[model samples]
Target: MPTSVSDRTGYWDRYAEGRSDHQASREEALKGAFGWTQYPGHGPGDEILGHPATTLELGCGRGDAVAALAARGVAATGLDLSPVHYARARERWRDLPCAQFVHGDAMDYLTQTDKEWDAVYSIWGAVWFTDPGELLPRVHDRLAPGGRLVFAHAPAVPGAYGVQGMYGGGFTGRQVWIYRWAYEPDTWSSILADHGFTDIHARVEPAPEPGLLGTLIVQSRKSRPHRMDDLTSSKV
Candidate 1:
């Protein structure tokens, strides 16, 4: 199996205008998939974000959601490992007031960045690239005490993608979305629970498209100091 996945952010820089061949179609599909409705910042931007908010969009491909957030007047940043995609995101969100793009590993950038954010959200699923073991700790460090993380993940049976994109035309083939890890909701929940996030919730969304692919949406609140007290008060 081809182990090295395409560096999406870096990969986009090499593409025409930092977009894949299906960029336009993909946009239309997402628009069609979601009915082209604008979000009123029902995320961290739900209430407080309209004022001045910090948000991170992990693996932001062309930054559609980031643009959405900015449209709602939120200060948002996007991080992706592929320099190509990062460039693409930059171009997409360049007009926004608080939009910035970074090209690096999600874990590394989250751990290393000193900025604090109110919320972090990743759409179109990016958790497949994570190393599982290391992903939790690094994500924990990036979050503020009361931060929220929402991961829109694509779930599959374990080891399912060993054939599809791995054996394709160098991962550049149209409709090639090679994701590792079966990504059960419980698996991701346990990971978040272990990383000091509380109030975790996961739901399988209605497959907004006509297919077997599924989106497992997980939303977790980063624990505050009170959480430790909650655990400690269980004295007999």
Candidate 2:
């Protein structure tokens, strides 16, 4: 188990070595899927993004989804903590001018940058690994008005909630631990609402095949300001 950020980075860097086989084809990369179902293109796709002009992806593994958004002419940027993953994403999607990759922690980057995005998302990425109590507020602050936050990850096991620890890809004999959050769909929505988000939607999507694990998809928006006209009309 990695106790510090640097150690965590090393853990993921080592884990990335075994992920070459998981890289998506350029064509398929351009049309991304939100869930990890066996059936191709299953579950909600990028349309859930609602055509954001600018977007950010947290823990973008190989940068496929970022490239997919770039292909759609969205200004897309991916932030990953692993140097190896960052390098791969940069090399694989170099041709896409609108797609950029940054190597850094999500918390550090979000705190340092004043820039905002129309949408921010994670596909089984940071939203799973990072503590939502700490991460969600930063996400809300980094979104432009009416901007959205969307993420998907495997649903928690029965009665499991809050931070859960697990071993990373065990290709090697060394045991490495990583932490992820687990919550039911309704609980996830409540967490987002408590963090000042609006239009919250969180649901569990059944697996493509029976007996397989389902995915938890969550989406919420930074509340847009109330119109003064509407306020006045309501008062009248």
Candidate 3:
């Protein structure tokens, strides 16, 4: 269970160049697997985050979603750590003025930028790849008051914390398998509550197949502002 940075960079750089699979397939699976409706229309019991606002997508792989959202009139910025992906995304969406692709660590970008967005989201992105304790607060800081944060992630198969799957016709190569944290729904709720988020909601849906693991989708709003020291110290 090594958490070295190199383990991620190496696998993702290779993944960026080697991914020949349809980007739309990946997006469709997420939308269907998570049962996502159009922006501002969400799963059952979850509040709509609103749409066509300034949005930031952490780990916006290949920038497909960014392009899609931009086409819908949302000002979207897609950030990723891999230059290989950054370049490809930039090239693919160059003509679309609404979509912007940036190359940098999501956390680093959050820490340095003075910009605040109306919505911040991730789809199986930095929320799992990085430490939640460190990532969540920064996300809170970057969102405007009343802004929403939505992210979706899936756990490994029951009794398993990690797995490896082949991709890109096997001709491109394989990516290194990385271990991801599997937290219960309550744990996610508690984390959001502690960080000054309100209207917190977590939904866990059964897997499509009998043996597969379910997906956890969490959405919360920055109801009000809190001091950094206060958010860091309290554990509720």
Clashes of each: 9, 0, 0
lDDT of 1: 0.61
lDDT of each: 0.61, 0.85, 0.71
Work out the TM-score per prediction.
Answer: 0.69, 0.91, 0.74
Top candidate, metric TM-score: 2
Best by lDDT: 2
Query: Candidate 2: where are CA atoms >4 Å away?
Result: 1-6, 22-25, 31-39, 169-175
**Residue pairs of candidate 3 with colliding backbone atoms:** none
All candidates in order of TM-score, best leading: 2, 3, 1
- In candidate 1, what are the lDDT values of residues 1-236, reduced to their tens digit? 45446544333344435345335553452342211112222223233222337788777766666666666567878777656677766865576787777777777686777887777766653555565566666666777887887776555555553223432235465533333454567767787788788888876654545564555667787777766667789754
Which pairs of residues collide in candidate 1? 9-82, 9-83, 9-84, 9-85, 10-82, 10-83, 10-84, 12-84, 13-84
Give the per-residue lDDT of model 2 (tens digit) for 9-115: 87888878878644767776565433443356788788888879999999998888888788778999999999999999899889999999999999889999999
Candidate with better TM-score, 2 vs 3 = 2
* Residue 30 in candidate 1, Cα distance off native in Å: 11
Encode model 3's per-residue lDDT on 1-236: one tens digit a residue: 34544456666777777787335454452242322322223443222456638989888778776777776677889999878888878887787789899898888999999999998888777676776777889999999988998887774345544223323224555544553555666777887899888888887755555555566778889886677888888954
